[model samples]
Target: MTSSPTRQRGSKELWLDAAYEMLVSDGIDAVKVMALAKKLNQSRTGFYWFFADLNALHIAMIQRWENQNTQNLVDRCKADATNICTGLFNLMDCWLDPSLFDARLDLAIRNWARVDADLEARLSAADRVRIEAVAGMFRHHGFCDEQAQVRGLTVIYTQIGYISMQVAETRQDRLARVPHYVELFSGINPSPHEVARFLARHV
Candidate 1:
């Protein structure tokens, strides 16, 4: 909706997206209602129409992150579980796609969790759900439970670490190493088709 005074009606996403942008670019502390109102060029009254308070907006933001990052990641991985290579490729897509994944937001929430026990527990639960989903994908490919767990953790933790570290690498540079990384993570060299498919997305 337009932010003009004529009609201040706006969708929940409009407010949430503004808040998310602030969270990612300026950290969670900057996601206040006043900042959001200013960012959207709308009056503070519009915010109350959508969210009860700053805490409500924060809860909505966290829920959005959980749905998009954790639940959706698991579902995508499971969708391609018939082929482990494809499944791995799908899982890696979360790392490669900005529209699908927001590393900045991920890291920001993790940092937020460090001091908030409830948020920490939420993140911990999301981690477990993600790990199990990836591990199930591996198990579907015939890996034993223990091996699947290890490989699952390897893939999940590796991506988290890559994101958490804020690694600096050009798109082409990372794409160049995709094949080798896939093989190392899955212990099976990706087929020419798989490699091409992956590079096609990232590059």
Candidate 2:
């Protein structure tokens, strides 16, 4: 009898994981079938079993990023918390934690969208969802619709700027600024407990 395939040799998740790493580390241009196959230490032909083509692989990578970084973050914010500020703090954790956020992947995808019209449209849709999620967090705290929307935009836009600019700041510097940004976004200073929890997760 023929032996079954080895887990290390090939799997959809393995391919997507390798592609994600490449896209984050080397940019989208480097996430090719042969490149991934080489990284995974498998034959390029094995890729066809999991993905139809390169485009399909790229699509899968986008979905993977969306599910992990976007949907997961929003869901965590929606988790049971004491109040809206706590929920917002949960969301901010995504930015502070590299494993949860993947800012490099986000930057790479935004760069890809610059040249790909389809990706641009998809990214625009995602931004709408993300902005609405942020607005919901504000509304939960009794903010008016307009105020919530404006605050939501401010938080997300500030995060995008921080990521895209690749700002160089020490971890201590960023930790010190967290409470200020939290207050700016929510219009209330976070409690000592909240700040401690947030810092504990990051620092």
Candidate 3:
């Protein structure tokens, strides 16, 4: 009979995936090395092979957020010349999607940063990157630089408000109203065809 893989054989990717799973499901407090090891059916030594400590894993999670989520949105907007508004709308959609948004993990990081100045600074830098990228996309879509900055701020604030309201309302209720808010902010009603054509150039 073939032998099953052992904990000692676990790879770095395996550990990272396990960490992410725990983060999404249970929050930062549950991201202990022992908890991860138990989740993965591995030993503490297995975790040590990939991360020096729980803090290292937390840092990796933050870095992954920056690369996978943040960079992807920024790049998507940067790539398309016509779909700036569509892309921004799509971003808000994705952010509110329960399958996509890890509320527990996000809250944990934000709360942790309250006690760590360095982490607060790092997170602030990350927020600036997202803000600037959104502003650039607005400018590309025909708004002047100053106008784009204001629009971008509007988009960001609207998204923040949506997230805050989500706690008190159902996701379906919030999503149903997104278009109205979007229309009020964007002003021009570009057809879906225009957005598709715009996005096609980047693809």
Candidate 4:
């Protein structure tokens, strides 16, 4: 998202985008004022206008990751769904769509958190909040407390594992199995109608 050749006035967001790209593409160490400015084709001083220091920029990136990756899943769980299958499918949308949930950024954060105790703490808290939200979805659909909790853990961990493993699979294959996955995770087989609608969205 960074522009070329010159500084764009009011490029705070451009700097953020450049930093985010660097963090995921390289690592946290790559997110320097000089590096970001070079990425944005702006002077190094431009970064200071938007952030006090690299720490401030780091905080901004973490907040974006939390808001986009964690909050989106929670909101999806709370979205309107006519049945358990449909509800679970709503959460699954994140796995299929990068914009809905950024797997790269999530993995990048997990890697970053390993070395940073404070960030690791935040990451842990975010995981709990996410699990609780998914559990709440099951509860809303009449699952027993234990069932809701276990299923929520299963659902969340399954995704985490997939991202961690960096498992490679084609979109077509994943789409074909969506219904089965929904049934397995939701404990309720989705109707053809529901499956078709969900598939239409991804396709």
Candidate 5:
């Protein structure tokens, strides 16, 4: 059989993408250089031509994830015209959708980081980026800096906790309970007007 054409991504970009997929689907242990090369239908030579080794690839993956996903989200929030709650809710909706690259990879990385110190540090850095973005949004919505920071951490942590808890729950069950959780997090009694306003601003 003829060989598959050498996959063409910039040297750095290709490895980053491969590492991201491996980490997401399997975990950090899945990100071997040879494995990545095989996944790309290439030889180890292809990987070596770019990265010095697997550790180098891992570092590049962490940096690329931070720049592209974490930083990008922060930038979007900074630019959003919606109020803090609306912007944050929109963010949560995006995170819960598996189709989004950032969210899918984030879930994978978070899972992997649970047992790996280096991975945990990378994940923590990304989390701080998100927390700061949320805090800025809250400040824009009339919260003082210190209060916004606290509220932002609470909102972010609550969202993460909810998702983690729902990992084994039926989608229907999770969907049914989302509003209740949202209400609790937002500290607002359930009301059609408030939800309408939230959707109008966010959706």
Candidate 6:
């Protein structure tokens, strides 16, 4: 018989996934090594095979967030687009698709940052990188540096408000609103062809 997920040996990925889930679902205090072992239905000894200690696992979790949430959004911001609306739609895809960005992880990290200066600094650095990518997108599409920066800040800050307010909405609900959002953020309505193209990917 196949081993159940709980019965499987502790791999690095498994340990990190459990740690990440704990971090997101119940905050960093709940991400203890013993607790992660319990969640995985494995012994503490098995966790040691993958992570030297709780702190190592915590670092791995933060790295995962940096890769999965922050880096992905920055990449999407720089993705190919024929127009500003199309470009903003790429950014919207990151927001609407959890696979592109883990909103819960982002929120949890922000909450944890409230108590940790090191983490807050890391988060601030990531914010700068992501906001600049958005600004760069605007600059490429014809906005001046100052205008691009303002629009970029507005785009990211609005989404931060949404994520901080608990991840915006369901995919279908949010998808319906993307065109209006893209228009408002870019100050130009997307053509029917552009809107159709963007919506087709999500729908």
| Residue-wise C-alpha lDDT for candidate 5, range 1-203, written one tens digit per residue | 75444553236577778788888778888899778878876778878778888878877877766776677667656765545445555555544444322655666667877887988987888788788887888788787888889877987787567545645766556555655665665555446554565445433
Q: What is the lDDT of residue 97 in candidate 2?
A: 80
Give Cα distance to truth, residue 143, candidate 3, Å.
1.5
- Pairs clashing in candidate 4? none
> lDDT tens digits, residues 123-199, model 3?
67766776787788777778898888887778766655544454676656655555566566677665766545434
Q: What TM-score against the true fold does each predicted structure earn? A: 0.92, 0.90, 0.76, 0.94, 0.71, 0.94
Question: Which portions of model 3 miss their true places by more than 4 Å?
Answer: 1-9, 87-93, 96-105, 168-176, 192-203
lDDT of 1 by residue, 1-203 (tens): 54464367466889999999888887887888888888887889889989999999989999989988987788777874447777788877887776677788899899888877999999999999999998999999899999999988998898889888999998778777767777887888888988787778775
Task: Judge candidate 6 against the unseen true structure and give its global Cα lDDT, from 0 to 1.
Answer: 0.89
Q: What is the lDDT of candidate 4?
A: 0.89
Worst 10 residues of 5 by lDDT: 92-101
lDDT against the true structure, per candidate, is 0.84, 0.84, 0.66, 0.89, 0.68, 0.89
Off by over 4 Å in 6: 1-8
Task: Give residue 49's error in model 5 in angstroms.
Answer: 1.9
lDDT of 6 by residue, 91-169 (tens): 9999768999988899999999998899999999999998999999999999999999999999989989998987546
Model 4, 1-203: lDDT tens per residue?
86653445347788888888998888887778887777666776778878888899989999999999999999999999988999988998999988889999999999999889999999999999999999999999999999999999998898899989988999999889888988998868799999999999997
Pick by TM-score: which candidate is best? 4
Question: Runs in model 5 with CA error above 4 Å?
Answer: 1-14, 96-101, 114-116, 166-183, 188-203
